[model samples]
Target chain A: MFRTILLLILLVALSYGFWLSPDFKEISAGVAIFLFGMFSLEEGFKSFSGGTLERVLQKSTDKTYKSIGFGILSTTIMQSSSLVSVLTISFLGAGLIGLGQGIGIIFGANIGTTTGAWLVAGLGLKVNIASYAMPMLVFGVILIFQKQKSIKGIGYILAGLGFLFLGIAYMKSGFEAFKASIDLASFAVVGLKGLFIFTGIGIFATVVMQSSHATLVLIITALSSGQISYENALALAIGANIGTTIAAIIGAMGSNIVGKQLAGAHLIFNGITGLIAISSISYLMMGVDYISIYLGIADDDYSLKLALFHTIFNLIGVIVMIPFISKMVVFLEYILKDKVTSNRGFDSAKYLNDSVLELSSTAISSILKETKHLYDNVFEIIAHGINTKRQNIISDKSIDETIKDKYSKEKVDIDEFYNHKIKGIYGEIIEFSTKAQSTTISNEDIERLYSLKLACRGMVEAVKDTKHLQKNLIKYSNSTNRHIQKEYNLIRQGIAELLRSIYIISRTKEEDVVLLLLSKSKVNMEKYDILSNGTLDRLIRADSISDEMATSLMNDSSYAYDISKNLISTAEVIFGDVENLGMAMSKEDIDLILDKKDN
Target chain B: MGIKKFIKRAKEILGLEDEKKESKKKSLKRLLKKLIKRKREICTMLKDKKSKELQEELDIVSLQIKKGKKILHELYKSN
Candidate 1:
């Protein structure tokens, strides 16, 4: 609400300024165009952010210095610290990179942002970049309308650079024209009072713009045109540094706990940096002056001096934070404690958070873990649903004897168990899978996600089939007729054995043996199904069982077969290795292979 | 009377009226027939594939099939 009110007020103020003076209008327009260019550039870069970026990010952030260098290099090339910050939060949330490494990248990003100030002050103010911008825009728009992603990405990059140049030209002229009408330099206070006031203005400008690089470029342009004093520019630079954390904070809002903690680190680092710069303002200005003299910069060249001052202060922040990184991480971990709720006998999703969606592998892994969780719960329910204890079924105890002994026990409400164990988690896995589909992921990962979803569906169907068979199972299990009672026991024993075999296969480490066992299990089910049909039909034909009993037995036998088949298929998805899963092997593929062998 | 007539007309247009019930039942019957046919084909294919794959384990399966055929013959004679 406060942000909305601030935005409304800013809009009204800008409108009033535009009406009063054309110069203010041009400056505001320049800022808008530059911010738009930033957004376009971020979009363009995202096109090439496939597995390569994630691989590079994972491999590069192993050590502190390498992570910092990565932050500096990427931020310099991308020219958007906000993008780097968001990626850091995402990586941290996905557990791909540690918290301390994330902090290091953010630190390097702050120092790297000074490159924008240097570019604007040194080249943009010197050359008529608008001339270059015109041709780039024409070609960029042409490429933007092309079909390919890479082409469109290039188009956005060209157009973004063009807009950036054009915006800089507008701001330079706007400040130049404003010098004739009004003297903002007259408003600049002297001493520490001027430092505090200008710093406040700098922070407000950056918070409103959401980009400190934009704020810095604006400060440099205004300072170059003599609209703002050199001392005031330095102070505004400090404010801009501190205010950029708002973007990181906003980006982390929808992310997981680690993201929020990293955002906290960003604020703390920037605040401390700003305080140090402000307290020793004179000393930093002296250092900047000394550097300016050494580099042969003119005393009146406040724009270059301001850029130097920006770099020095950010460097100071990084240097100060270096000694206490481990301490900082511990403090952040202490402050942002993970929320622990009662287990309640149902497993909540461990890795399926919004943050994991940023990376495809992370998203895929999270889905796999959550599916395994659902399978575990389903394991217990399916065992108990068949009127056999899971321990007895999986143990060396004969499944036939176990069912024969315990068939008279009270039946488990398969429907109730489905609701309690499978329904909520199944919904979450599907929801998470559907949500992950929208993210930029690899084709292989998408296939994995879809396959996992189907596995969950198969498990649910198996449970529903069990529920259907439960009614007749209870009725015939205690029947006075010997033939019908034995046949029902066969149905229960068949399903229990299949479940037990699958449970064992899922835990085994030997892939080849697991595959062979799974195939044999498939054959075993077929054999049992054939036997059940024959035995039930023969009992009815002998006039040993009634027609109703025979019909129910036939239907229950089919249900048992289906339940076992679906459970085995689900196990293959959960337990099979990527190489042997043969998810890529379709009927058409098998036929083609067989044709080749035949040839 | 006017509102009732309008609602009835709307239901007819939307295919929610009872007059559309016969066609709905026919379509449902057609779907069930298609499903049942598919199920039988799948069962036949499954039986053949498993018999072939379970070569060493086919002894028990053959006995089961032989028994089922004998009972099926008895059922047909009784009918």
Candidate 2:
């Protein structure tokens, strides 16, 4: 409600300003266009993330230096530190990268943003950029209409650059006309008082723009137009750096705990760097001038000097804060503890955070990971439901011993386990998958997503089947009739063997190994089907078991068969695609293998 | 020549006529190579162990190699 009122007030103020001065309206339009260009730029960069960007992000960032380097390179190429920070947060929320690595990337992004200032100061101010914007816009719009993803990505980039150039040109012209009417330079205060006031203004401007790079570009254009003094511009740069953390903070609001910790790290890092730059302002100016002279910049070139100062101070900030990253991670983790860790039981989706929903690749990766997490829970429930201990199954113990070692003396509440462990996470996976597929993801990713959703359903079905099989499993295993007891025990051993094989498959990365184990499990499953082989009929005809026992065995065996089939199918979708290798053989092949088996 | 005809001719000459088929053929060849190596290993292991598991593995590997080779053949034949 308050936001509505504030928005209404802002609209009225904008209207008033537009009415009072055409120059004000023009400048406002320039800022709006610039912000829109940034959005387009982010979108353009995101289009490429389905391939090299996402792959590089997952493969790189093993070391702190590599993480920082990735941050700098990505931001410099993309020309937006805000985009880099948001990606880092998404990566963290997806559990793709660690907190220390995320902080390094944020640090590198600060330095990377300095390249934007250099681009604007060194080239944007001198060139007639608006002329270039026209042809770029034409070509960009044409490519944007193309069906190919790469071409569309290129279109967005070119169009974004055009809009940015046009915005800068508009602002420059507006400032020039405004200078003739009113001397904005006369309003500049001196000493620390002016520093504090202008710094506050810079913070407010960047907070409104949500982009320090934009704010810096504005400062450079204003300075080049002789509308703002050099000292005040320096202070504004510091304020812009500090205020940019708000973007990371906002990005982290919907993300998981690691994302929040990274945001806190971003805030604290930028805050200290801002304070350092402000306190050492005179020394930084001297350093910038010395470097400027050495590099042959003119005495009148305050804008380049400002860019130099921005780069130098951020470099210094990274150097000074590098040692503190480990300490800061400890501090942030202490402060922003993951609530999921403290609350035990009733498992929720750990990797399905909103931040990862930004990209289809990240979304697919997270859901795939969350499905494995669901599989973990299903393994436990199925192991316990059949009265076999989970550890014994995963162990290298014999099947007879694994079946002999029961999970509990009392029957586990299968319904409660289903509700507590499986249902909530399964519902979340479905909801998140639907949300993901609704986005502008490609058809291929959508197909992969559909498969992941099916895997989740299969896992849940397996657990429900285990629930149905549990009652008779408990009753018949302890019966006086040795024949019925032996059959029930064999059912337990069958499931135990399937669970162990799946556990091994889930852990191994070798496709051949996965294929071999899957084949073995299928053969074993067929071997244990007593009803299909007439073992149950043999027992009844020979008067070895009663009629009631036969009925129970028939029903229980079917349930057990379903349980094995569902879990095996689930494992195929989850663990079978080892590096996209065909780990799961076709049903025709499996049947052929079983038929040729020399028993 | 017209632009579309020129492009289509260029793609055929460059062996980029159909990207999916090209990649599938490449991956199938790679898998077939691995399966052949695996079949050889299983054959050796069977000579040493005389185990049922080794024999089953040899059969599966041989079948997979046959399947991959057939797919690769069809991919070329259609082209």
Candidate 3:
């Protein structure tokens, strides 16, 4: 609704401008074309981020200075701070990077954006760039029609540059024509009053345009053409700095608390930077003059001086605020505490949110992390349900000896356990997956999501199977009949052992070792089957156990096998890196393992 | 006629006389035929498949057909 209102107002303003002057229409069209180029440029950069960008970002953000360098380099190359900020927020939302790391990136982006001002001041005004734009557009349009991804990406990059140059050319001519009719510099206020007013105009224009680069270009072009004074342009630059935080704030709106906190940091940093610039304008102007004189800049070279002033003040802000990063993180955390859901006993999702749906990678990441959280809880519940400690199952102890110990009947309540631990997260994952599938996700990603949901279901089913097996397990653990008790103990031992192996596999980084261990477990699974081993038949034939006891043992053993199977299957999907192993325990491989065991 | 008799009569009408002469081979051939037919049906259904359920079913049936064909090939070699 807010966007719609803003659009309507913009439409009204543009319509009125078109009626007043044809020159205004040309300028407005130039701005529109320029913004479209920004969009295309962002798209072109995004096409290359399949894994390399994410990997580079993850590896580079380990330290404060490193993160800042990464931020500067990425924004300089991408040439769009808004894109950088959104990517940083999405990474923060997915818990891929720390809040401090995110803030460092934002600060570096501030300095990185000064490069754009230099480019426009140093070259854009002096060069006849439109002559270069024609061939670029022609070649770009030709390449855009090709089928490959990289070709299309390069096409967008070339076209975006072409449009940017053309837009600048058009805007320059239109502004020159407008100046002939009426000088905009005549309306410029002087001193402190003029500073605040122009700063406000700068903020409004950046917020409306959502690009500080665009605003800087406009200011530089106007300053060069003598339509705006250098001092007022300085104030406008400060406002543009503050206004760019709106993109970060808007990006964080659909994110979790961490994303919002990073946005808060952005606003505070930019807000403080703008205030400092406005207050220390006179002092900074003296410094700029000294630097300008030292660099041999002429008195009439306001555009170059403005670019230097922009760089210096941003450097000052980073220097001033760098020491207080830890404190800022603490303050933001204290203010933006995670909201606890009232009366809910279990923890809910911290990362999954509707805003992340804008990017497929972030959405998949958030869900993957949430599913990990679910699995952690499920692992604990499974341990407890089996009447063994979680540590013991994952430890080096023999499970055959471990199941000999008796557990209290009071602990394993499947219904209450399901309600508290598994059901809510399971439902949320299924719902989230269904919603994700509706988006324009790739088929491979959709299949991955489906497999994840199935893994969750497998976990829940394993718990249910354990619930059925638990009664017989506890009952026969203390049974007087040695044969019946021994059979039940074998069943318990088998499941506990399977859980231990899976637990071990889950913790190990060696994929080859894990794959071999999983295949061996499938081979060993057949050994525990009482029917295949003839244990039940041998005991009944000898009349060592009652028929009722034998029947109970048979049924309980099947449940045990099922619980292990489902749990192993779930583990394979969730943690085992099944794809690298070429499908989880194919039947042929299992048969081969069986044959080896037999041999 | 009863359903079993009707099936037998249909087989006879379809000129499956050689199948009756060797019951073991006949059963193996019938299974192979059934599996191949199911595979063809799955392939057709999968062309414009919309649901994951259908995809999963197709995968299972395809696996089953592959295994069945392997077994049928082994039986032919033995004969």
Model 2 segments beyond 4 Å from truth?
Answer: A339-345, A540-543, A578-583, B1-37, B68-79
Clash pairs (backbone) in predicted model 3 = none
DockQ of each: 0.01, 0.28, 0.01
| Cα misplacement distance, residue A154 of candidate 3 (Å) | 3.3
Top lDDT prediction, candidate number: 2
**After superposing candidate 1, which stretches have Cα over 4 Å from the reference?**
A92-101, A250-256, A286-301, A326-330, A337-369, A383-413, A432-449, A466-599, B1-79
For all predicted structures, in order, the TM-scores are 0.72, 0.92, 0.83
Residue A272 accuracy (lDDT) in model 1: 96
Model 2 residue pairs with clashes: none
Candidate 2 interface RMSD value: 3.5
Looking at candidate 2 chain A, the ten consecutive residues that score lowest on lDDT are A577-586
Q: Could you give candidate 1's per-residue lDDT for residues A329-376 as a string of tens digits? A: 999999987798886755566667887776566677678878888888
Q: What is the CAPRI rating of model 2's predicted complex?
A: acceptable
Tens digit of lDDT per residue, candidate 2, span A23-119?
8888788888877888888988888777467668877788888888988899999999888887888788778888898999999998999999999
Report the lDDT of model 1 for residue B61: 32
lDDT of each: 0.77, 0.84, 0.77
Q: Higher TM-score: candidate 1 or 2? A: 2
lDDT of 3 by residue, A1-599 (tens): 99899999999998999999988787777777777888888877665454457778899998999888888898888888877877887788777888899999988888888988887788888898789888888877776676544456667888888888787777777788888877989988899999999999999898888888888888888888888999999999998888888866776777778778988999998998888899999999999999999988787899999999999998899889999888999999999987776846765666677655655666788788887788777777777777777777776777755674545566488777788888888888888878877874655578778778877888888888778877777777668998887887777677777778777787887554465456556756776788887888999999988888888888878887777777777778777764422435676755654454456
